[model samples]
Each structure stands twice: as C-alpha cells, then as structure tokens.
Target: MLISALLVLHVIVAIVIIVAVLLQQGQGANAGAAFGAGSSGTVFGARGAASFLSRLTAVLAAVFMLNSTALAWIAARDVGEPGSLLERIEPVPQLQEELVPEDEEDENERDEDELDLPPPDSH
Candidate 1:
C-alpha cells in the first residue's frame, strides 16, 4: 500500500517536472530586445527566471529520487516465509519414478533430433 502510494507520487512529480520544463523558456531565448528577444537590459535580469526554474526543478527532482528509493526499498524487503508452489498447499512426498536421471544417451538423442531438422530455403 505504501509502495503504491509512493509510486503514484513519483509519477505525479515526473509529470510536474515535464510540464514545468516545457513552460520554461529555452537557453537562447531573450526577453529584452524587440519582441522579448534580446537580454540586454531586462527588468528581471539574466539569472532571475533561471534561478526560479532551477529551484523548482531541483525540488521536484528530489521528490522523484526519494520516491524511487522508497519503492526500491519496499521491493527488496523480505517477506515472512519462503515456500515453493508445491510446498504451500500440501506436504507431498517425492516420487522416485518421476525423477529424471541424468544420462549420456539423453544428451545424444537431443542432439540427433536437433540436427535432423532441415534448413530453410530462402527465395
């Protein structure tokens, strides 16, 4: 439950980061000259917008990292007990006849069967 919540939060943060980055101006965008093109003598100055965007991006990025770490920690946690599919339901005794014996003949038969197949004819 906690892990699921954390995953949802991480997804939300990712979306926020994407939206924030897209709304921000590019590196070469100038906000002073003509149609907000040049950055000669702007009121907000050079690093104002960059500083705000950087801080916002940093906060969201930190949240994303934290949620990722939390999810990983939850996934790596050990459960109460470990048991096989057969062992979980009932305690069945092993059947001696069902066991496969490792023999050289089995290997040779497999190889022969594989080699007998014909190769494909490409047009």
Candidate 2:
C-alpha cells in the first residue's frame, strides 16, 4: 500500500516537472525581447518565473528519483514472501480435480504401458 501510494505521488511529481519545464521560457526567448517583443512587465517579474520553475523542477525530479528507489526496494523485499497475489486467494471449487476409480490394471501392465516399449517376443 505504501509503495502504491508512493508510485502515484511519483507520477504526479513527474507530470508536474514536465509542465514546469514547458512553462519556463528558453534562453533564446530573451533575444526576442531585445528586438521589441515586450518582455518587460511580466507576471513574475523578469527572472522570477525562470528561477522558481527551475527550482520546482529540480525538487520534483529529486522526489521522482527517491520514489523510484523506494519502489524498487519494496518490490525486491516482497520477492521472498511465500504468497503473491494468486496464492492469497482460494481457488474455486470447480477448478479442483476429483478422484475417480480406475479398473484393475495390474502393476506390471501399468509399468509396461508407462515405458511405451514393445512387448518381448516369446522365442
């Protein structure tokens, strides 16, 4: 359960990192401002958005790595346990084999049949 929760959180953080990276303007974006693209008077000031997004991306990436490590450790730890998902559940009654009586085929005949060899000649 803990590992599952961590996996979900890891995925969310990874998505946030992707979005954060996409939101940040590239270095070349500033070059457009120099030619009158109007980079001034922005929402997060001149440099605030870049720094904040970069920091957020870094923190989330670290979380993603830590979560991945934790998940790997948990999976490895569970490997030695006796019961996995299938073992925990009881099998349906209908799937079980039923005992049936067979006709009296002697031991020697059973053995010869099992060996699948031809019978010996009676010289």
Candidate 3:
C-alpha cells in the first residue's frame, strides 16, 4: 500500500516537474525583447514565472529523490514475501510426461500412424 502510494506520487511529481521546466522561458526568449515585443500575453509576465517554476521544479525534484530512495529500500528489504518465486510455482509432472513420452513403443506407434495416412487425390 505504501509503496503504491509513493509510486503514484513519484509519477505525478515527475510530470509536474516536466511541465514546470517547459513552462519556463529559455534564453532565446530575450530575442523578442529586442523588437520591443515585451512579455505581454504571458501567464506570469517576464521574470515572475522563471522564479516560481524553478522553485516548483526544485521542490518536486527533492520529492522524487526521496521517494526513489524509499522504493529502493523496500525492494532491498524484500518485504511482503508470502513465498519465494520458485516456491509459489507448482510442479508440472503431467505436462512433462505429455511432452516427452516414456515408452519406446509409443514413439513407434505414433510414427506408424503418421505413415498410414491416405494419399491426397489429385484433381
């Protein structure tokens, strides 16, 4: 339960960080300022979004790192092991027997049956 919740949180934080990084303007955005375009029609004007988005990305990254450490610890500890993987699987003696018959007579009989097939009639 705890692991599942942490995993969900980790994914959400990752997505949010990606969005935040994308939303922040790059250095090339300043080219528009040379033409007096300014930072109008933008969500947080020129400089405001940069700081806010960077802070959000930073916090989300910290959360992601902590969650990753927790998940790694859980895997290392091997919790909730009702049984080992090999022990949980049931033996398949019947399948093995069907796949490989024990008697030499069975193989000979099968070969004979295949050879006894009627020849196809040509049109």
lDDT of each: 0.74, 0.77, 0.77
Q: Which residue pairs in candidate 2 collide?
A: none
Runs in model 3 deviating more than 4 A are 32-50, 79-123
Candidates 1 and 2: which is better by lDDT?
2
Predicted structure 1: lDDT: 0.74
TM-score of each: 0.51, 0.51, 0.50
TM-score of candidate 1 to 2 decimals: 0.51
Worst 10 residues of 1 by lDDT: 42-51
Q: Which ten residues in a row have the lowest lDDT in candidate 3?
A: 41-50
Give lDDT tens digits, candidate 1, residues 62-116: 9889888888878778455576666678667987776566663465456555686
